[model samples]
Target: MNKKDHSLLTRSFKNISVLFFIVVLLLLFVVILINVLFGIYTWDRLYMDLINALVGVMIPLVLFNFLYDRFTQQHKDRELSEKITETMLLDEQVIDRFSNDSKKAFIQKSTESILGKTVGNMVYDTLIQSYLSKSYQYRHHFKYYISYLGDKVTKTFAVDDETIFIFNPDDYYFVREDLSFERDITNFIQSNDVRIGFSYKESTLDGLYQRAEFMFRENLWVNEEHNSMLQELSNHEMEQFVKSFLQFTIEIDGEVVPYQVIHNEGYEGFHLLLDIPETLHSSVLSKVHIRFQMPQLRTQKKFIVMISEPTEDVEIMFMHLENEMEVEAIPFLNEAESITRLPNDTIKIDIHDWILPRAGVVFVWNDRQ
Candidate 1:
């Protein structure tokens, strides 16, 4: 249910509960009042009067204990509910805090913080639906988190830095391919409440804040641009693209030299980047290899590279991934070409190579997944 409905139900529950208890309290008071007047006019003995006085005191004390216990739990439940509502409100406000650039980044970070470094359309969709299904997993934790209601509630909350986001952890069936930041966030918060209890943990707030702050200090979604496309580029284009993207520059003989990346005509697909000594600026002593296309968000496109000194004996030894994805070491040149995974899943390929250069080296791997 939505926040309004959830809150309204909570209020209704509280109001009815309180009204019922108040009526009981009033009945006891009326009885005492009636007895006092009757004893004042009808009683003839002090002993009888003393007994009535003791009875009046005992009745109020009983009602007081009953009301205190009931309201104590009621107050606790209300506090937890308020926190949950606050979390939802904060999430709604975040819709404006982010920009198009950081949207995917923030979502990936938020997802990774919970599900770890795993990527696939299936994994993302499953996690989202699992929270929305009737099998509300977090219900008990939220229900008993702040009160003694125990684990009767099946709803959950991802409490944040002064914000609370409701969640569900259960075996549910919901398969949606269009998994995105807004959709997932909305589904996570709009889930129906189940049972009645609470579970409080400081980490809950930490998780929510991590994502909320994604574009807070710096608007990540606004300015950060992601370039992930599969295409072939001529050597000249590759050089300019990679250099600009990496801001790559080198110092030669105490002076900074900007190197141009070139695709190998003989290899047909290898783009090379090396700081050419002014002497061998024409020689082929380049040091880097261009592999598969660049990656983005949670997509681990086949990003690979072979790096070694032209003077050293080596086969593909390194790769990088600045994103989330699973990559395998595929030997390109020879069976003896030992392969190793890249760092951070980021193979910074200058995919913008399509702008300049013509057929010098033919890029391999044209099939799309």
Candidate 2:
């Protein structure tokens, strides 16, 4: 029966029980009055008979109520099980799409809607355990992690079998970016403007800030047109020339932020170590701005931005001096959501979905020959 029908039946049964008890009491009072006035039976005999009748009636009534309640509960459980099975059959793909943790949560919510909080939790435990057992199969020793009611439990399942590990989605970090590059071909210079926003997930430090790192790398390649002059410079002179043309500024939320730079021994890049202020710790999103100007030689036909972190949204725009150069931008490894060319020799590419590291955009340009 449905919940409403079950409730109505229970109420009706309770009312019948109360009415029967009242009727018994009235009958006993009438018997007592008859014995006192008309002497229908002796007081001792009447009391004994009354006690036997009461016991007989009460015993059967209590037994019937107990059996009925048990049957109703069994019916409800069976019905719920059938519904769960049907849902699984219809939404197999949907369920498979959810991560392990999300699957557990979905099961809890779906079951809780049909049962009381306490019973729902009990049902959730049984269902989730069954799901994990069937979904995860191992022949030998396997270490499995399961999240039950917000608690994580790790246990070895099946010794002498292949091991399988499940990764937690929460452990993944994601960031968003808005990057722009402006080229001034007249001076062989390019200005880069980047804005990054992210949130902290894991950290191990004390104080009002969390330590983070950012790396920047720029390489200069000489072509036939400029090889003679560049090749004449010594290694030390070349490094100095590259450093002299690079000017950058870092800011957090509009205010300038300080960082310690660590230059690579043999590379054309450096690393910046800074602390994220406590104000943007776990609650608020943090925004970092990096702007830099570097030499853009004629031989450098392409500028690539590599995604080294999990990114959700990225907007890249490239603007060059009109009538000076032509550029084309393309996404590597993944397709962009939108690519638009605006006025003033500008091109913009946007990626609006989650993209993993190593996938990024490449901008290729050439002089207007």
Candidate 3:
């Protein structure tokens, strides 16, 4: 290296050191000046120290409050969900109890009168009431306008080994995949021992009437034990029925979502499991059409038998018989062996047997729906 280059490097290094010293000295001077001013103002150093310490404390405290708020919100959300589910379940029971012979004539008369006045109105009335009775709330998002493609829409209702459901002018577009509303609905129906059928309105009031007439005729003429009136169907008859009649949309954030309600018997308690998209699990609300049959009162206690998720926690609500003098206390008798894993996610439960009678079971979801 040349002497001139070495001298230039030394000078540059000296300047850098002086700048660094000035910066450090300035920062120290600011701190000292702050302390002196604070002292002159008769401020306690300990108090100031405590204030600073509190600021440090508040940083975490603020973070903790934020976390706590989130957690509390979640808890409140879960509680609200549970309440809605419970109300929906109760409404289902009320509607089911109302659908007996006692109310059948009233329903028919009202339904018939409504049908005469408007097309596809009969089924709409029934579905709306049935759903509204068991839902958080109900709103007619849109009016159904019936237009017939053919001469008449033929609907056949038949009973077989299993109960069948039929309704006209289906709003299948309301079936949403995100809400798991279908699952919630099926659970409500099964809990109440109900079944349902679905149909839709075509273009014109006449077409709606024709479809309603078909459903009414089928319901009246078909044997009470009939599964379906339509014959020559393959093994997937019920599947076909579900595909054709029941139309629904999943409700999320007050928006209607498109989905199909596929009949499922995989779970003993429920007859249908709605295959929904994963995205809808958290925000979707469900509306189910169910037909509940009152448990036969063969003895002093009404006994109902059902199968459900063995490991699942369930809540039961019973409708006290009107004439009964005293309500019987429910006794749960788990007959199955201790299982680490539930059997087929189903355990047969008897509501009234040798011990107790006339009880209903409601299943609570862990907000997965």
> Pick by lDDT: which candidate is best?
2
- Per residue, candidate 2 scores C-alpha lDDT tens digits across 136-201 of 111111111111111132221121253222222222111112332211111111112221221111
Rank the models by TM-score, top first: 2, 3, 1
What does the lDDT read for residue 308 in candidate 1? 12
Candidate 3: which stretches are off by over 4 Å? 1-225, 228-273, 281-307, 310-313, 320-369
lDDT accuracy of residue 208 in candidate 1: 28
TM-score to true structure, per model: 0.20, 0.41, 0.21
lDDT-wise, the better of 1 and 2 is: 2
How well is each residue in 299-362 modelled by candidate 3, as lDDT tens digits? 2122222221112222223322223223333334444212121232322222222221112232
- Give per-residue CA lDDT, model 1, range 225-284, as digits (tens): 211111144454545444543233333333443444444442222222333334423322
Least well predicted 10-residue stretch by lDDT in candidate 3: 212-221
Ten residues in sequence with the least summed lDDT for candidate 2: 139-148
Q: How do all the candidates rank in terms of lDDT, highest first?
A: 2, 3, 1
lDDT of the candidates, in the order given: 0.33, 0.48, 0.36
